[model samples]
Target: MKKSLAMLLAGAMVVASLTACGSGKKETTAETTSDTTAESAESKTVSDGETYKIGVLQLTEHAALDAANEGFVAALDDSGISYEIDQQNAQNDQSACQTIAEKLVNDGDDLILAIATPAAQAVAGVTTEIPIVGTAITDFADSGLVESNDAPGENVTGSSDLTPIKAQISLLQKVLPEAKKVGVLYCSAESNSEIQLQMTKEACTAAGLDVEEFSVASSNEIQSVVESAVGKVDCLYTFTDNTIAAGMNTVTMVANENNLPVICGEQGMVEAGGLCTYSIDYYELGYIAGEMAVKILKGEAEPATMPIEYYPEEKCEFVGNEETAKLLGIDISGLE
Candidate 1:
């Protein structure tokens, strides 16, 4: 009977040991689940708390560029995403753009916004991983920024402000219907201006008009170049060349003296002195760029995959500087 009692006691102890082992296994499983839950919550918070930073490189502080910057910032705000914008104006200097790009890359911005062709090229040369959005650029293909206008197919994409070549020619023909020979003046070093010259030459040929090109490397050459162009051509076409646009007073004086009606690529140039122009809304282009930045931040889009966007329709307006118009003797209302 004592030996039976001892065996029973030993069996009871074994049963208790098994129950304790089972309880420990259940607790271990519960603890593991709790740990995984905590880790997931932390990851989620991290993602939610991240604030994006954007670097902006503007080639100059001209009206068009300023409008673009304003539009871009507004669009970013509209996205409901928190971001810090680091904006720098390059003052129309290519070296300044390069320096600004290097600084942005060194600062490790989430993305870069290039406001013009020069600024875009500068940033693109800096880094590939940091996404880039460009605005106010004309002819992504001619700028060498991408392979095609439809699909940039690289780490850079943005909106272009290229007015339709045919439309521009039509506007010119409407304003100066009797004029035969047209002279195109631009900065030789500006690739954007070169693209415009090429397009203008083609469109003028189609319009049964003769087009001649005159190039100025800097501000000092404007007088001599303008005098030569005015002496030869009946009308003058000025592209959105920064150098010439910045020295517009001189261009207007020379052009008006020669009675050469000028048509410009951008509104700012038109306002300064040109007779009339059809241009893209640069501010809207910038706003589109801001929208692109949000997609990059949310990981919803990739720069290499983002196709370059263009304005739905070009915006046309007549500056009608009465004084300048009278000097050119262009019957503004008659043209309409």
Candidate 2:
């Protein structure tokens, strides 16, 4: 009897040992699963105990781009999203833009705010998995940034600075009705400028006017190109060309010297000395982009589904530069 009892007691001890081992394994798995869930939740929460990193890739340092950056950062602050912004400018160089995009991608930027055409293209080309927000991009379709403007159908979406080309042409015609040939001066490298130039050409053609094109590959050739173009055309029209806008005075002085009036794409250009423009509010455009960013950062929206936004027609206005008008001896009495 004692031997049988000893054997049973040993059997019971073995069963207890196996059950404890099984329980330990299950407990370990449960702990690991809990950890993974916590990690996933943290990743989705931008307001978690972490500082989100934003990369600001600007094509160049200009007033418009600067305003866009300021508006984005200001909105981020207002949204109370903890963030660290790494702002960079490519200085209007494609190679530099490419380099910046690569580095930012490698750095694992949570989101990227591309301020212009080249910068947006550079970043969008590098990766499709990352979210990219464009502020002053002219045409997403023409620029090859997206499949369509209404529904971007890509990982990029933001505010478009596409003001009314017809209205701009009308303002130019109104300001200089007798003008026959209008010079379209722009940087050939910027797709935004090219798109605007083509629109202007079409609009000008429809209005029964002749268009003269003056394109330079870079800013260095702007003055010389303008010198040649100013003689052939009655007036000058400058679009949102980063290279040309960099040397604002170069084109303005060349056009003004030849007694030719200049019309521009935005108020900053006019403020820089060009005559007039039916321009969009660049600040407001930036602010809208900022609001979009807030939606993205808060996990409320995805760039993939966000439609491309445009400045409302009411937000765009016919802005005239009184100083430039005086210098060109153009009467402003008709504008008011």
**Could you tell me which 10 consecutive residues in candidate 1 have the lowest summed lDDT?**
36-45
Stretch of 10 with least lDDT, candidate 2: 28-37
The whole-model C-alpha lDDT of candidate 2 against the native structure comes to: 0.81
What do the candidate models score in CA lDDT, each in turn? 0.78, 0.81
Question: What TM-score would each prediction reach against the true structure?
Answer: 0.81, 0.83
Best by TM-score: 2
Model 2: residue 235 alpha-carbon error in angstroms: 0.2
Clashes per model (N, Cα, C within 3 A): 0, 0
The candidate that wins on lDDT is: 2
Taking all chains together, the TM-score of candidate 1 against the true structure is 0.81
Tens-place lDDT per residue, model 2, 4-110, is 99999999999999999888642111111132111111112242555676777888877877787777777777777766666777777788888888877887888
RMSD of candidate 2 to the true fold? 9.7
